[model samples]
Target: MKALVLAGGSGTRLRPITHTSAKQLVPVANKPVLFYGLEAIAEAGIHDVGIVVGETHAEIEAAVGDGSRFGLRVTYLRQEAPLGLAHAVLIARDYLGEDDFVMYLGDNFIVGGISDLVSSFEQDRPTARIMLTRVADPAQFGVAELDRNGRVVGLEEKPEVPKSDLALVGVFLFTAAAHEAVVELKPSWRGELEITDALQWLIDEGHRVEATVISGYWKDTGNVTDMLEANRLVLESVESRLDGEVDAASDLIGRVVVEEGASVTRSRIVGPVIVGAGTRVSNSYVGPFTSIGANCAIIDSEVEYSIILPKASISGARRIEASLIGHYAEVTPAPDTPKAHRLVLGDHSKVQISS
Candidate 1:
């Protein structure tokens, strides 16, 4: 079996950050969300992989070059535009030729890997297999309706009134039969070919379309909140390690990882927290679920439950939590004049001013 990883698409939801970087490349616990997917694919024993990339192709390629590092031989399939999932399938027809493959969404985070799902598909040989999870907002995702006997009966794409809460997770397994369905699919009302439509067509033709309802954690890390949540989830599994220098005045509480070359002086850190390589935290409080990236500086500030990307710095700030700081960004105290709120926010960015 092979793998097709979709790393393309304009992540408008994570704007400002996505404006400069691919959403899949955004770090969760200092690791790219896409890298987790790649590792999962490798763990599934699928070495022949095809990555679908779009405008941010250069960035993705630079990070995942040759795929040898991940135990896979990768061939990139370029999509001209951010069409749709079905469109991605259509473009990857050549690379995925006649092979049963798994399509993994780069921005999605599944707690447990898809090894069991792949094994099941290999044994049963279903025409297509989709991962489903009960979501609160099924209307926002492609949903599935199952019969009483646990059979997938229908599929819907962002329904106004969803028939079920079984939202489609971002992992899919498909035989070569899915190619014809994708080729025959028409554009949806949103001017894009929908994968749900292709799966529906498979059902109509009496081909076995199986559904695996995942009970484990599944999150589509498309927005800042989801990203931070994913970072926290991954950090939960991080073991305690202290390779870096910590002053006697500093207090380390709980499971914290201070990478080599990192320094914490006269500060307090509550984990699950990680101070990346060459990072320095002085006279500050790095609270739980916070990931301070490489070469960052945190002084006289208090930050918690946030992701600080590489080269970012925070100083003299009272507190920051549940935030996603981008690369090379700085979070310092604003000028003491005027006591007014100042924010330059991106589209879809949310801020709750606690004044």
Candidate 2:
């Protein structure tokens, strides 16, 4: 079987950052989210892969290259617009050919890869298989309604009135039979060919469509909150390793990884934290669940549960928590000498002043 990974979506939810970078390329634990999916596909023994890319195709190509880095031969499929998931399958028809394939969303993070899922699909050989997880807001995702026997009976895409809390996870297994369903689909109300519709079509036509309600950790890292949470979860399993310099003045607590060329002086780093290669942390407090990207500088600041992208600097900042700082960004204290209030307020804008 092959793999089709979708890496093309204008991530409006992660604006300003996504404005400059592809959402899939956003780092979790200093590794690109897209890389995780690719690695998982490789681990599943799928050597032939096709990556669906959009406007950031060049960037994705540069980052992934020939995919040899992930032990897979990747073919890049260009999607001109942000069409629906079904449309991605439609465009990848040529690359997918007659083989069964797995469709994975690049920004989604699933703990303990999809090897078992692939194994099950190979064994059971269902026409289409979807992974579902119980979510708080089913309306935010494609939801599946199972019958009394836990068989998938109904599927809806972002329904206003959801029939079930089982939301579709980003991983899907499909045989070549799915091509017949996707081709017969019409654009949904949202002006895109929904994948949920394709699966529904298979069910309507007497094809075997299966669903698995997964209890494992899965996250669609589309927004900032989810990104930070996924980073925290990944960091939890990190082992303590010090390949870089940690001066006597520094105190490194549990499970901290100071990567090669990184230096820590007069700083205190708590557990499950990773300081990327060439990063410098001096006179700072690096708390838990933090991943500081390569070449970053943190001086006289305190940061926790945050992701500091490559080349970003946080100096003299009081504290930062649960934040996603973009690459090459700077976080420094404002000028203290000019403490007087300045007014350039906009209409209907609310401001809080410390008096």
User: What is the TM-score of candidate 1?
Assistant: 0.95
lDDT by residue for model 1 (253-349), tens: 9999999999999999999999999999999999999998899899888889988888877777777778788777766565543322333233233
- Model 1 scores worst on lDDT over the 10 consecutive residues at 338-347
TM-scores for all predictions: 0.95, 0.94
Stretches of candidate 2 off by over 4 Å are 335-355
lDDT of 2 by residue, 1-355 (tens): 9999999999888876787789999899999999999999999999999999999999999999999999999999999998899999999999899999999999999998999999999999989999999999999999999999887888999999999999999999999998999999999999999999999999999988888889999999998889999999999999999999999999998999999999999999998999999999999999999999999999988889988788888777667778788877776666543322322211122333222
Of candidate 2, the 10-residue stretch with the lowest lDDT total is 339-348
User: What local distance difference test score does each model get?
Assistant: 0.89, 0.89
How high is the lDDT of residue 187 in model 1? Answer: 94
The segments of candidate 1 whose C-alpha lies over 4 angstroms from its true place after superposition are 335-355
Query: 79, model 1: CA deviation in Å?
Result: 0.5
Residue pairs clashing in model 1 are none
